[model samples]
Target: MSVSNEPTLKPERPFFSSGPTAKFPGWSLDKLKTESLGRSHRSKIGKARLKYAIDLSRELLGVPDDYLVGILPASDTGALECAMWTMLGPQPATVAAWESFGNVWIQDAVKQLKLKNLTALDADYGEIPDLASIPQDNDVVFTWNGTTSGARIPNTDWLESGRSGVTINDATSAIFAQEMDWPKLDATTYSWQKVMGSEAQHGMLILSPKAIERIESYDPDWPLPKLFRLKKGGKINQGIFEGATINTPSLLATEDYIAALEWAKSIGGRQAMFERANENARILEAWIEATPWISNMVSDPAKRTNTGVCMVFGGDWYESLSDEDKAGVPKKIVSMLEERGVGYDFNGYRDAPPSLRIWCGGTVDAEDVKRLLPWIEWAFEEVKASHAN
Candidate 1:
């Protein structure tokens, strides 16, 4: 525990990247079903496997009976783009962003889509956007959880129950770990690489009847890409929701997602995953509270996320360092931790303020988090000592 010495105890499972996060507990490649691997995606077995994966998602996430849940190419970003490009132009649009991924949505709305009547609501890092201020009857776009900032919307109660506009939410980091008001959400997107801890490249998109109506009724003046085309002959393509993907998909990744979903079901479904993530986050947040030199970047418990908990230097000595030196402290601590084999990829997002982001998603073991804390404290102490001298 000395400042100059590394912690003897290290986390056994410390692969904590925010996305493509640690896999489900007891996960192994050999556990995946191989029957669907080499078959044509359109064939009977391939379609059956894909449909089964979608069915599992619908059941575990508690999607509405009428909602269409399907897999999309290009991970969460592409899925969000599919929703935004197809459904946004019919009404006045509004986009809210507080972190990196959310900002990408804003840019797409303003710079890419070129929506004439658009309202962009933004908040500083470590803060949540004001959802209460969203204009009524405007197609709203936002992320349920700000992955980079470690801030998340506390609830969806602010969304008008009877609003006319479609609400497109990037729930890439919020899916299984958060309780979403499914009825109020129109077009919601998440990634397998996130909460499910599955392979990357594929994203899940959920669409309500309202969102479907938007796609079926409105056509943007801009030319639609083949992948973004949700409508065929001015009617919603029901096939896509039924395991018909726009492009070829990785069957291996599909099996991996199916395995993760099965594991979730085995462990008491979404509630258990939520609890696991909450407990993991609580461990790290509690450490921040007890440790004098560091603090949660989000500051407020209500606004903070249960995944990707961001940390900031809060000690008096850290405050006294030059801005340049202060910026390097987190990197130094992260590098130290990596070198010690206690953690990896815990550094903050490139665009985010110099900080560390520890993934505490459902897949991350709570015991690993508890063991990782002392090592983090040790790293911070060593970094602070180096800066002090």
Candidate 2:
């Protein structure tokens, strides 16, 4: 492999990990000045700050008035457990496990909760199960986008409009980056650390009226953990949906989320955010089309996710290597990128095939992605030259 010239351009900000993604374009510690620190979250000003976050999120994301949006103690996982424990026992379950995150939900539904009636729909990395097979008669749980594999459901057309069952969506990496069909979703969960590029340690749970009605009317036989409780005295905890969180939240994170929401609103809200994300992805797509040595991990364009843009090494020379050596290529490429401070945490998820998983969320500028492309080729050539047999 002939090495290319060393690249001089680099992304202005190299914080591209999917979780704890890049913050708004000009974020700094000064942005936390408005944070309500040293005060109880139960205090008047504290609750107001929390409410501000929820209100801004609802407004910026175009959440309907009929739905309830709230902050939860755990990151996306905690909010998911709250939904499963509160709403799943009475309904027969159908889970779609396409990638690591979806598989986690399936494991929770089958092993952790020990549900008696379960139907699992599965697919390998970079693919999705047959979503049409999901029955409306039973609860269906799935991730909108497989963060690790970079696969996503193309749309919500498979969901029946007036179904009896509930739809639980883990949209941690999808929200903000993609347009959500709220009418098709009963329960949606995400963390601040994802698309919004805020700090973690908290989750956001959005429940449709039907989801609230389901949990308020029915109770699961299993004892709910303190973290998973959504009902009290045979009624839904309305306070939780109104900024009264289940546990204490990080004030700094709350303020940071609010700042991100403000930034989203400044840039024309959700629509603008979606366009920016898509534009960043387009930059990568153009690069992938031109580059012969790499290809998208997702073969199907429709199911591909824009944010977690995953790619694999290709070409005859690479394929001739043993599986072990093929796996080592991504590590070397990632190490080269990080060593040069051109990108960080660009390695694929552990459970997925070895590849580069670059974050292309709205917070990331398209120009930066353009700057990063040449460096990827430079890193690949450096690694290939060193590994020449």
Candidate 3:
């Protein structure tokens, strides 16, 4: 892909797109360039920085003292898979699937892991499955926020407090954008790209004391790959959850993660990040209310996501247009915005309804969202004008 020489069409406010969302406020490529490069990850200096990054994350997120945070391979997907394959089994499990990612976990549990006594509770993209009836004795897996569908569980109080089963939460897009009740969760996973505004290779896995206990005691009769091994003969591997990663991580990416953390801290930490996301979402909410054709995918106001704000067109806007023209609307709108260099990746997930998924995470400011909304309207108009016969 060749770089464009055309002058950038700066947005009046800012731009938003769901994942690999906007860069951290005031982030610069030069900052990444200046970071120490070509350092051995296991060396004392590298380890110290890596440990600092983990400690900083714990402090910023208000993670419990007993929980262990580890940097894993790939992104949130890898982190979730690691948790599923490692800790699940030897007991009946229940999966709550309301979105693409949660469904992926359901498939993994029933088909890949071959867990026979599993129950899958699901709903369409917009709402959560009824949690009131799930057995309290079975392990539960759910995504705290549905990045693809823009629906999120507003609270963790749904889980029975004294239940023996565990709760594994995929909180990739939820961590910084919303308040997470750490005490209510057992194993939580997130990615740097979603809320941290970093590269997508690193996954953060935090295991609570209860989660560690499960790993230490449960001896499931499943073969374990090196990547999925968290315990050895009922003994939890404490070192892996520390600075020691399963495989070598990109030192540069690690440095970038640290830089992103520093940037988060500089902006008044998690509360400030939450405020930024809420403010951006409010801007979009106002836009959605006034716009006749568009509305949020998540119907419930409280369940709506602050990050990954997805909007679907109303009524027969699609039926009115010819198939060829209708098929091209989303692509045309996305391309127009991209050509203007105002936003990227506003297109919805392939599996989702024909909608636009905008990023309202902390990395993006409200001003950017305000600017991008007008361009979105302009793009729709331009596309309609060109496509109209």
Residue-by-residue lDDT tens digits, candidate 1, 234-280: 89888888998888899999999999999999999999999999999
Clashing pairs counted in every model: 0, 0, 3
Model 2, global lDDT: 0.89
**Which is the winner by lDDT between candidate 1 and candidate 3?**
1
Write the candidate numbers in order of decreasing lDDT: 1, 2, 3
Expressed as tens digits, the lDDT of each residue in 219-298 for candidate 3 is 66788778777875668777666677778888777777788888889989999999988998998999999998788998
Clashes of 3: 3
lDDT of 2 by residue, 1-389 (tens): 44679988889998778888998899887867564888989999899999989998888778889999989987999998789888897878998988898888889888888889899899999888888987788899999999999998999988989899999999999999998999889999999999999989899999999999998898788888888888888888888888899899988889888888988999999898899999999999989989998999899999989899999989987998899988999889888888889999988888888798999999998888898888888888787788774
Instruction: Quote the positional error of residue 268 for candidate 2 in Å.
Output: 0.8
Q: Ten-residue segment with the worst summed lDDT in candidate 3?
A: 1-10
Give the 10-residue window scoring lowest on summed lDDT in candidate 2: 27-36
Off by over 4 Å in 3: 1-9, 12-15, 33-36, 322-327
Q: Please state the error at residue 110 of candidate 2 in Å.
A: 1.1
> Looking at candidate 1, what is the lDDT of residue 361?
92
